[model samples]
Target: MKMNIKSLYAICTAALLAGCTDLDVNIESQYTQYPINDIAVEAKNADVYFHLRDVFGRRYMEAMSLSSDEYTAVSYGGGWYDSGCYSHPSLHDFRTEDASIDWMPTVISGITKANTVIRDLGGEEAAPADIAPARAMRAFFTFIIMDCWGDVPILDYLPVTNDEVVRAPRAEVARWIESELLEIIPQLTDEVSDNTYGKPTKWMAEALLAKLYINWAVYTASSVEQYEAATAENEKLNDCIRICDDIIASGKFNLGSMPYAEKFGPDNGSQVEDFIYAMPYDTYTATGMQYGRARTWKNAGDVEKSYYGMKLSNSAGGYITMNPEFSRLFCLEGDIRNNSVIGDTVHVYDPNTYQPTSEIALDENGKPIVLTQTVSLEIPDDVQLGVGDNTKGYSQGYRSVKFFVIDDDYKNGRNQSNDLPIFRYADILLTKAEAIVRGGTATNGETAMSLFNQIREYAQAPLLATTPSLQDLLDERGREFFDENWRRNDMIRFGTFENEYGFHKKDFPTARFEKTCRIFPLHRDVLNTYPHWTQNPGY
Candidate 1:
């Protein structure tokens, strides 16, 4: 069951605390009365938790890149493709129709439910591991709000009356997220189920908390005690570093030297590198999105097509493509990272036979060549250049091959495996590097440089002998974690929230990429539901 945002909200708000009600009432009065004791098994309803997870996942996939790329003016939620397609677009308008899914309510709902579970399942009556899971789940959801939409009304549980639903500011929300994670960190169990590999571990909490602190500038506006805040946040990052180090030190997980494709392949879902948090998609027929059934040809599967015989694209092809600038950043010769993440030089689509199952062909020596097997969309043929350089046939140019699946099983389209890498070890290392850079330190400090160089070495990309500048760390982050949703926050931390990119710099008529556009507006309908809640500044 897909856990919709509304369901999370309903579950969180509906949480009935252990002592809040009396049990001696008449049985006939209630048609479906789940005694508080009955709620103990509710944690097993991973279905509900999974839905909430999906809700958070959707927000990350869609809304996480407000500060990184260019701004193209496509239809639904125009900001992403417009701002995202290029190296750096001047404006990433948040108020447009194409903004990320309204993630506020869904996250709030999850946090509420998790807290309620923690509150109610604590007595001697609670199950062996229920409380830990509840706390972990709560921490997971709260981190999303703290990281994405700043300043939310942090409700510990569902409000008894409508008046209690008023929202809180970003700082207060961050504190609340921190408090919840700290409260539950010690309570969670070390051992987790195999199916729950991506589920929150104790280390995951620390990492997420560290991430929240890493973006302290955007969260706190760097107006007060910026150094202290950065320091404090970095401390949390260090704590996270320690946590990952400890996990690594133990025999539980290890870095796999497997090729990048094999590392992310479905068979390795249970592998140690993948042992970090990831969403597992199974092959069960009715089992909720098993096998990457992408909705477009860009995604390797039997999704739909465009009416004009062009490949039907989703959301202006949130299709992950490499930015030309990012591509240039990489060393073309002998960089294994290039081969691991980047792929087939070109991805050309045939309009005449653009059927769901029609095999994509390539042009070799000016002759169309067809491969024996089904092909995944890797680097696309589209290459949109600057104003002066030829602009013909380059509208949909320069695609990313990082998330494109090329394993053999996806011949006809879509596979039942391939867990999406939400948070990975590479991210952990990158975050540590960024935190060290932004944590009230010098531009060329050893602490930050060491972390940054490790990533460079891992990628087999050249590393700098001298320490890196602060901007260097941020730029490196862009290259290391592109399209993974860390760009907006990293840009904001580096003080580039308002820069322009792609065609948006000269194209957008009304919007300018300003710092004021950081947080999303409280959805208009949500404001109608709760009038007392104040919208974020400048939204």
Candidate 2:
């Protein structure tokens, strides 16, 4: 596997990363041979992980947070009015290239790297154990692409021509991913150590399968226009339970292992035991993780030093705000998640020791800074967003503290060491409980109520007294995973993505049930590059 290149296929990699090859691409050039297989399986796999980091950044967050009911952002009178693209998700009135669409190429970049590793290793048959992780990661990237943009292309090898780049139907893509994951699961590592830290393991792969099964109906449905979330049923609900049971029985994860807030701080990494899979963003080495820009204020380094033990280098105050309806979920007495969402007024903490001080945070003219949970996303025409540096939100909505920062983060400026949790052990218990509630009898002796209460009881919140229903499970998911990028998926599954929450309504009523809005249409560039492809219905 020595290095050599100078082929159109090499150039096609760049094209594919930008999207599929253009129509004018010279198909015959793909015939030129190159000995570019110098990339090791591990190096190609590392590239896959790094490419995924770019995806979880800006555009993806706007789509996931801004679209869903969990959080929203507006002009705030000064900024965030990105020509109305920022509010398109909430309003359901979108133009091409909205935040939700660009991740296709970014995700494709990761998938292409994973595919290259598979191809260079002489295909999956030659080194099943040595290269199985790449196959697993490839499936993970495909899952994101499919979840976001319904019917999409599936590339197993480098295409020699544009004709090889046709889009696969959504159902076909899901089935192919399922078969690929099933074949590679045994080859995946079973350990949960540093060797497999950010990479997918047997448990994480199973978790992915369980997720696919639970959403089988939605993915395979002819159309979501008439879909009902309350009475939704999945034929693979039984399969989902079985997969979740295997992970739960392994005894590797525990909710009681750490305090609720500690699960997302700088100390939360692979060894934490609560996370099944996470994106390991670090302070000194890893980069591209800036949660402060989404939640913290601009002058936090000078104002609220009592926060995470370092002076934050940057912040985008009011760039995002919590929705009132979703904010009510944190009202349970003694729930740790409530402490993270700052509302009303509280004392300012000391910076040096990160301790509580007698001094309270006040706005410009000596007034207490208070956070509000207003029902409307609109601000009165005469009101202002930021008056002075000291204000927390005298006229603002609720703020968040998820994906918290710490002292080590000071070294990397705005970037943080907080490992982003994708799947957690609590999700396993909840998924199995949800599957059972949806008419799949648990093969194990565990009842739906027993498994469902594990998450709530451990979080120190009240436990459910009766059997959980679909709506109850939906509400519980909203509470458990607010800002972790799970809201859009849950909202779609529950048939609520089309409804207006906080910011969608400005002057008049805007909430209605629309099917096409369930999944975003293919990007404009994608549609134009491949003329044969049709836009999603009703787009």
Candidate 3:
């Protein structure tokens, strides 16, 4: 079924409030709008256009988080691992066709909408503003494909028929994105408008180009000449000294003045300082899906005396948690990100009203545990948690705080106003530092760690040695961008895609995956449906 604005909005609102319409909204279409002169017809098209834009952001975040870091693992106590979905048969192995399904349709659907908008706005009589959004949407979708699948079926020319579709190599896709951004940069407004703050400005295009170059080795193995070619394509990266430098000089974005926890912690409704581009969320609009809450176990009660929350008379459960290996990487002290993103404290919830009670402890195993003896919604203490031994089923696992649900308002398994950071300033600085390292420049004598220190300073963490090596940069990226969805690519870039990490990497099931696994398989559904389509090699 075609996704219309009303329908997409309805789903977001429904998910936020379980199922209710207490909050109502009428969003104007970013494309396909009725002209004031032709209000009725324009309104119809606008409605469809706006829904298309919504899907673009929604799908973009979900795909990136799942495919990249922005997540904790569940290996020990039935937790999710960064590579669990990447290598397991029943989980998410990108080596085969099945792993690409969930995100493929959403992207293709969004592309369809973008194509429609571009077509309608380009017709004989249409406002230029109507097409501005279309151009932006196109760039956004193409960027996703470029980053994720690498060599993708570029639909820039729009559909002639399914038979006409052909796959473009990774290098070509990258070029397309670079070209699209350059073409549209002039059309986009540089102003930091409210809803559009996280939207792509010309600077975002520049930053993205830097990111593309920084990871160029991972996408395609061209020699030094190819590397230089990528750098040449982005005059902006040079103009800004680095894309991050450009973003800072732009003076539009900043690190949050608040502490790290406030910036990425439970009480996340407040404006985040580092957001360059993000997906807007709003509780009142009833349109936010708190992935953070979804990843977190419902730990509101326990055994003592009804602990801290009202016991729902009944319950159904699902399993997801943090991996022990991934969690251990956080320093016990000094790194502020540990406290902000990973809270070791256990908050007991009152059974009468689900609020936290102060009591944190660790089990004999050294894992943190919460005491919820009194309430129905209880997250088990570590000693009692399920570790998939058939005795226990995986409880007491660490919950995700990346997008925390702080209050009953936009809180508790749902928060709308918490915008998803699509791009951040720190990302820029690190990308530039990496590019400089690879480009053979040590003029500053400041190595990758020096650049990493700049990002660390923003996170309020201490700096490493000023002239650390390339491996240090890779490790820092892992820690800093963990679960943020850059792992598969980073692994490839570091030449670790086939290698393992810690214990999990030892007995990985589908171990044939190599650097080639960096790119996802073309969707089987698409391949099967289109007769002339060809699959990627090694798939």
Most accurate candidate by lDDT? 2
| Candidates by TM-score, descending order | 2, 3, 1
**Candidate 3 residue-wise lDDT, 401-505, digit = tens:** 445443443333344344455567677767667666555343335455666777788766677766656676676776676645565556556554444432123
TM-score of 1: 0.70
TM-score of each: 0.70, 0.86, 0.71
How do all the candidates rank in terms of lDDT, highest first? Answer: 2, 3, 1
Model 3: residues with Cα > 4 Å off, grouped in runs = 1-92, 95-100, 123-130, 160-163, 222-242, 265-270, 283-288, 298-318, 341-358, 361-386, 389-399, 407-417, 440-451, 502-506
- lDDT for each of the candidates? 0.46, 0.67, 0.48
User: Per-residue lDDT tens digits of candidate 2, residues 19-105?
Assistant: 222222343543332233323344445656556664675567777777788875644544555655566665565556765555676
Q: Which runs in model 1 stand beyond 4 Å of their true positions?
A: 1-45, 56-59, 70-91, 96-99, 119-129, 192-195, 222-251, 266-268, 272-275, 283-322, 340-395, 406-416, 438-447
Best model number under TM-score: 2
**Which tens-of-lDDT digit does each residue in 1-539 have in candidate 1?**
22232243235335632322211223243233334453534533343355454543344455654345512212122322443332122234455233354556666666655544444455335554566566666656665665565656666553543344655666776667677777766765555445346566666665566666665445654422232322344335455455445544444443456654455443446554534566654333212321122112232222333221233222122233333444554553444545323223333332222112233323312332221111111222112222211111122334343343332323322333445655666666566665555443422333666766776776667777776776787677666655456676666666655554443353445445555565555666556666677765666
